[model samples]
Target chain A: MRVSLFALILVSGITFTTAQEKDELPALDNPHNYIKLLAQDAALPALQGEEKFILRESWWSGRMEPGKAKLIQVQLFRRNAYQFWLAVPNRNGEPIINVYDSEGNLIPSESLNFEGTNIVSTMIQPEITGVYYIRVSLKTTIESPQDWAVIYAYR
Target chain B: MTRFFLFLAVSVLSSQWGLAQEAPVKIDLEDPNLVFVSDSVIPIPLEIFASLDKMGAQDWGRQIESRDIRLDANRSRTAMLFGLVVSEGFIGVQAQDKESVRRLGRDVLALARSLGVSAEVEEHANAIVNGAGRGEWEMVRQELDKTRQTVINKMKELRDDELVALVSLGGWLGGTEALASVLRDNYSAEGSDLLNQPELIKQLKLDFNGLPKRARRGDLFTQVSQTLEHLESLMRSDDTGAISEGKVIEISLATRNLVEAIYES
Candidate 1:
C-alpha cells in the first residue's frame, strides 16, 4: 500500500512539472510572438477603410516591470495622423499607453482597449511637428516582469 | 502523503497570493526621471516625405540627385552610403523617376554587397527595380523601406550596432537635406516645423560618438561628427520649437554639405 501511494505521488509530480514546463516555455522561447499577434489584432481596424495607415516596418520592444513605464521618443510631423499600439503577452495584465508632447504635456488621443486583452493603443495628431514620447506601463497583478512591444502606423 | 499534499497546497496558495496582490501603484507623472528612456526609435525617411507631400511641396523630381557610388574599403562608409542610396530611392519614388529608381536599386545592391549582406538585400533590390518599372510607386516605397530594414536587421544580427546606427543616420541626413531644400524654396511655419528635430539630432550625435575608434578615424566620419555638432547647435538655438526660414536654410546648407562630403570623400 505504501509503495503504491509513493509511486502515484511521484507520477503526479512528474506530470505537473511537465505541464508547468510546457506553459512556461512559450513565453521564454518566443517572447515576441504573442505581443506581435496582439499588436496586429489591435491594428487591424485602422489598417482598413479609406484612410488606411501604413505600418512602419520596424517596432520597439523591451521588458517592463509593473508600475514602471518604458518611454519611446519618436518624431511626429504636423500633417500626419499616427496610431500607436502597445501589446504584451496574455500572461501580463492590460497595458497603459499614453502619448506626450515635447513639453511633457499629455496629448489627447483616440484610444483603444478591449476587456480581457493584453493590449492598449492610442492615436495622436500633433499640431506641431516635433518629438513625442510614447509611455507604456503594465497594470499587473503578477510580480514578474513582462515583455512588451510598441508598433505604430501613420496615414 | 501528507507532506506531498501540503506542498501542492502551498504552491497553489502562492500563486493565488500573487494574483491577489493587485493594488495599483501610482506613477508620478511629474517626475522627470520616472521612466528610463527605452530604445531610440528614429523616424524613417517615409514619414518626412509623406509630411512634405501633405504640405503640397512640389518639385520632388528636382530633389533627386545623381550619385556615383565610389566603393570604399571601409564598411562604415559603405553602410552610410547604403542609407544615402535608400533615401535617394525614396526621392526617386517621390519624383516617379523610373530610371533613377532602377539605378538607385542597383546602387543599393552594390552597397549591400560591400557590407557583405547582398544575399539578403538582392531580392528587395530587384523588387524595387520591378516595382519602379511597373510604376508602382507605393510598392517601390514599401520595398525601399524593406530594403533598409533588412540591411539594418542583418547588421544587428551580426552585432554591428555601429553600422546599424550609421545606416540610420545616413538615411535621416539624406531625408533632412531634401526636406530642408524643399522648405527653403517654399517656406512655411508648418512646413519648417518638420526641421525642428533637435532631439533626433542629439541622438544621432550620440550614435556617432558611440562608433568604434577605428570607424571614427575616417575623414568622412570626422566631417559627419562636426556637421552633427553644428546641426545640433542650430537646432537647439530655438526654444519655441519653431524653426525660422533662415534656420531652415542653414540646416539645408549644413546637411547638403555633409551629404556631398559623404559621396565625394
Candidate 2:
C-alpha cells in the first residue's frame, strides 16, 4: 500500500521526501502542500473581492489528534482586516477555527465554511491591536490524527 | 474528552452567534497543557509597515536613514544586515524615495553575494532597481519582499537555519524600530497598542537562545539579547492594557540604538 501510494504521488507530479522524525504519519508526508492548496482555494472569495488583501508568505501547519485543538498566536494590528484560512486535506471532519484576544475573550468574526470542502475561514477586524490566538480543531468521530494547515491574509 | 467536546461545541455556537451580542466565552488562559505551536516563521516587515500607514503615519521619508552596509566577516551578522537592508528597502518604497530604494537594491545584492546566495536574488534585485527607476513603488515593494524570501528560502535549502532566524530577527528589529519611532512622534493609544507583542518577543528570545555558541558570542548579540529583555518587559501585560507613550519612546530609543549597533558596531 505504501509503494502504491508513493507511485500515485510520483505519477501526480507531487514530490515526497523522507518524513521528518517528528512526524508520526509517514504516509501524510508533505500534507502541507495539499492543505496549502485548499487554504488558497478557500481564500479565493475574499481575494477576488473589492478589498485588496495580501496573502502572507508565512503560514502555520501541524497535526492534531481527534477532539484536540491547536492554538497559534499572531500579532494583529488594529485597522487592518485579517482573514485566516484553515484546511484539513482529504479528511472527513469539520474543522473549527476561531480567534481570541489575549484576555481570553473571544473576538467576533465572520466565519466562512464551504459546503463540500474541509476548509474553514474567519475574518476579523480587530478592535484593538495585540496578540490574538487562533485555535484550530477538527470535529471527527474517527480516532485517527489529522493534518492541518493555516494561511492568513490581511488588508 | 467529553467535557472538552462540550466546551468546544459551546464555544463554536457562541462564536457563530456573534460573541459581541452574546456573552463572551473565556478560555482557560492558565491551562498548562495549552501549548501554542511555536511559530518558526516570523512575520515579514511589510505587515507592520502597512499598519503604520493605516495609523496616519506620515513623513516616511524622514524614517529612511542611510546605513553603512560594509560586508561583515560574520555570516550571521551579514545575514542579519541583509534582512535590515531589505526592511530599509520597504521603508524607501513607503517613502517613495526612488534613489534610496535603488541604493538599497544594490546593497541587498551585495549582501546576498556576501552570503553566497546572490544568484538566487540577483533577479529580484535587478527588478527592484528597474521598478524603482520607473517609480513603480508597489512593484518595488513586492520585489523587495521577494528578495528577502528568496534569500531565506535559499539559506534554508543550504541548511543554515541559524542564518534564517537571524535574517528574520534583523528584519523584525528594523521594522519594530521604525514603528516605535513613528509612534513616538505621533502618540496615540490606538497606535501604541500595536507594540503589545510579548509573545512574539518571547519567540524571538527563544531564537536567540537557540543560536549556536559561536553565533551568540558577540557584542551585537549581547546588545540584541538585552534589548529583547527590555522590550519584553515593557511590552508584557498581565491584563489587557495599552502600551503607554513613555514606553513607546523607550522602545523607540532601545530599538534605534540596537539597530545602529547592528549596522555600525
Quote the TM-score that chain A achieves in each candidate.
Answer: 0.77, 0.78
Q: Over the stretch A29-141, how does candidate 2's per-residue lDDT look in tens digits?
A: 46676566667766756766677787776788898886787789888877789989888865576778888898887888877766454777888998876778888877756
Per-model DockQ? 0.21, 0.35
In candidate 1 chain B, what residue range of length 10 has the lowest lDDT sum? B16-25
> RMSD for each model, in Å, please?
12.0, 7.8
DockQ of 2: 0.35
- Where does candidate 1 stray beyond 4 Å? A1-30, B1-33, B236-241
Task: State the lDDT at B93 in candidate 2.
Answer: 86
lDDT for position B172 in model 2: 88
- Per-candidate Cα lDDT values, in order, are 0.79, 0.80
Give one digit per residue, the lDDT tens place, for model 1 in B1-265: 9999999998865543222112223434467876756467667767887877886757888888888989979888888899889999988898899999999999999999989999999999999999999999988998898889889878988999989988998899899898889889888776777887888898899888988898778777888998999888776435565688888899999999999988988
DockQ, 0 to 1 scale, candidate 1: 0.21
Positional deviation of residue B25's Cα in model 2 after best superposition, in angstroms: 3.4
Question: Mind giving the per-residue lDDT tens digits that candidate 2 earns over B15-38?
Answer: 543323222267777788786787
Quantify how close model 1 is to the true structure by its C-alpha RMSD in Å: 12.0
Model 1: colliding residue pairs: none
